[model samples]
Target: MVAAYPDDVDTLVAHEPPINAVLPDAAGAARARAGFYEAYQAKGTGAGMAAFIAMTSWQGEFTDEYFAQPAPDPAMFGMPTEDDGTRDDPLLSQRSWAVTDYLPDAARLLAAPTRVVVAVGEESAGTYTARTAVGMAGLLGREAVVFPSHHGGFLGGDFGYAGKPAEFATRLREVLAD
Candidate 1:
């Protein structure tokens, strides 16, 4: 039940040929055409073509709407960093990009869920994954809550699951129960 980008899911399940490689085929072409129509209607020809190009090229970028407002305090969040101290790992970067790429689909799933909560480790804001989680939560009309670490700091290098799983679980249970 974990929702993710079509491409990310492909990565997880090891889909061959990748989803982007098939867009020019019959069904994909039709869908693309329809998508262009919709985009043009909403945003005009130039923006629509831009979107279409981004879609086909797998170069979709994240926007503020993909994140929540009054974002979790940055001081408390810490995204995963490379050994060189850069917050850019290939997989994590892809996850972030995929989240942005498939936002419309994710929004649909969020709308259908009876209950949804977006959680991010206080340490990942501004990073791709954190931003994705924030964006997804915003689309779903859910609040993004940052749980404190064992040391009471907000940031950790782990993917929002660092420091005291039990406490975090308990907090999550409480939130869900409410």
Candidate 2:
């Protein structure tokens, strides 16, 4: 997968029942601290803090999405499918299904000689989109390449790790030449 920080994001993003529901702000912070301690007990302070930040950020984003969706019920709200069997519980089936069901289709697409290129940014260390790209590549049995950027197009600005269309065209030409 194109994950900048695979382990941390996956842990936070995979949690069921949503983090906000289980821990309030203070409790959440406390739990994060404890988790950091446990995680870094052997690794070091940097690893622990990184885990804390990743989990906390994931909690915030997931909480926002959780609150934005309708209340619990299969027809209205549920766990995202991609996360369903990955976890032991079920909350939003439809959402989970939507996220998990794309594998076959993605594999089919990647199987074509369409020059699939999975790009990751140097800065998106713990973002879900980056993680998702990496995961999709793995599922498709393809290798994802990391591309460093500076400002716009594929190499810079807020475009993240996404390749610019023009850059892709040029890269395609180079590939064909070889």
Candidate 2 structure quality by residue, lDDT tens digits, 64-101:
44334332222222212121223221221123333333
> What lDDT score goes with residue 76 in model 2?
22
Error of 1 at 1 (Å): 4.2
lDDT for model 1 comes to 0.39
List the lowest-lDDT window of 10 residues for candidate 2. Answer: 10-19
Residue 49's lDDT within candidate 2 is 40
Expressed as tens digits, the lDDT of each residue in 12-65 for candidate 1 is 111011222222232433344345345444544443444344333321233333
| TM-score against truth, every candidate | 0.36, 0.32
Task: Quote the positional error of residue 51 for candidate 1 in Å.
Answer: 28
Instruction: Per model, state how many residue pairs clash.
Output: 6, 23
Candidate 1: pairs in clash: 66-135, 76-154, 76-155, 77-122, 77-123, 78-123
User: Which numbered prediction scores highest in lDDT against the true structure?
Assistant: 1
